[model samples]
Target: MTRKLTSQDAEALAVSALVYVANDPVLLPRFLALTGIEAPAIRQAAREPGFLAGVLRFILAHEPTLTAFAEHAGVAPAAVGEALKALPTGDDRYLAST
Candidate 1:
């Protein structure tokens, strides 16, 4: 049976993905290119609304990245979308898959 993730769980996954991207040699470059965020700016950018969900969405855009992060985070791949929904950007919507 597949497990569902709570909002908190999704938040955890997004944070974990940030960590994962930072340590990764390959994915790191992709993140920087896509987000136009340098390594030094990650901390500050993370504080912005929908940033976490954007990270999750980036991973979701690529199936392999999504699978890898899900495995490392110990969460069902589908959970990422749920997490985005839970994170209220106060008007800025974060739609992952649903």
Candidate 2:
């Protein structure tokens, strides 16, 4: 039976995604550029709230990246989206406008 995905699992996936991006010459620059996070400050930035969610978001935004990551991680591509929901701010609920 498949185990339920928890916040901890999602966090681990996000961490792996972060590492995947960090190690990629092309993806690392794009991630840093988009996140406005310095390469040197990545460890510190990872500790911040919603950072992991952002990492997932980054991976999700790109189909090739997501596919590569999912294949490499041995998870279904859809699992990344499921894992996102397990993390804080992953719901992406927009406040109703007045």
Candidate 3:
């Protein structure tokens, strides 16, 4: 049976995505620009609400990054999209969840 998703699971996905972004040579810049977060403050920025989700969204936004992360995370690329929908960020527009 598929496990019911929880907030923690979403957070985990976001965190993983963030880590993926950090290590990526290309995606990292996009993350900084999109997030308006400086490289020095990544750890602090990661603590912000929706920040993790944004990381996932960033990955989802790019086909290459998404594919790479999916391969590294051992999840299907579609799972990232599903995770985005499962996670709630209070911002209805970007929440992805219905």
lDDT against the true structure, each candidate: 0.80, 0.91, 0.78
Assess candidate 2 and give its TM-score to the true structure.
Answer: 0.89
Worst 10 residues of 2 by lDDT: 89-98
How well does model 2 score by local distance difference test?
Answer: 0.91
Give me the runs in candidate 1 sitting further than 4 Å from their true place: 1-5, 89-98
Give one digit per residue, the lDDT tens place, for model 2 in 3-92: 778889999999999999999999999999999999999999999878999999999999999999999889999989988888877875
- Model 3 reaches what TM-score against the true structure? 0.80
Where does model 2 exceed 4 Å of error?
A: 1-3, 92-98
* Better-scoring candidate (TM-score), 2 or 3: 2
Q: Rank the candidates by lDDT, best first.
A: 2, 1, 3
Between candidates 1 and 2, the lDDT winner:
2
Identify the runs in model 3 with alpha carbons over 4 angstroms from their true place: 90-98
Query: Across residues 1-98, which tens digit of lDDT does each residue of candidate 3 receive?
Result: 66755667767777888888788788888789887889999998777767776778888887988898999988888878777766657246554545
Q: What is the lDDT for 39 in model 3? A: 100
Candidate No. with top TM-score:
2
- The local lDDT score (0 to 100) that residue 94 gets in candidate 2 is 23
TM-score of 1: 0.80
Indicate the worst ten consecutive residues by lDDT in candidate 1. Answer: 88-97
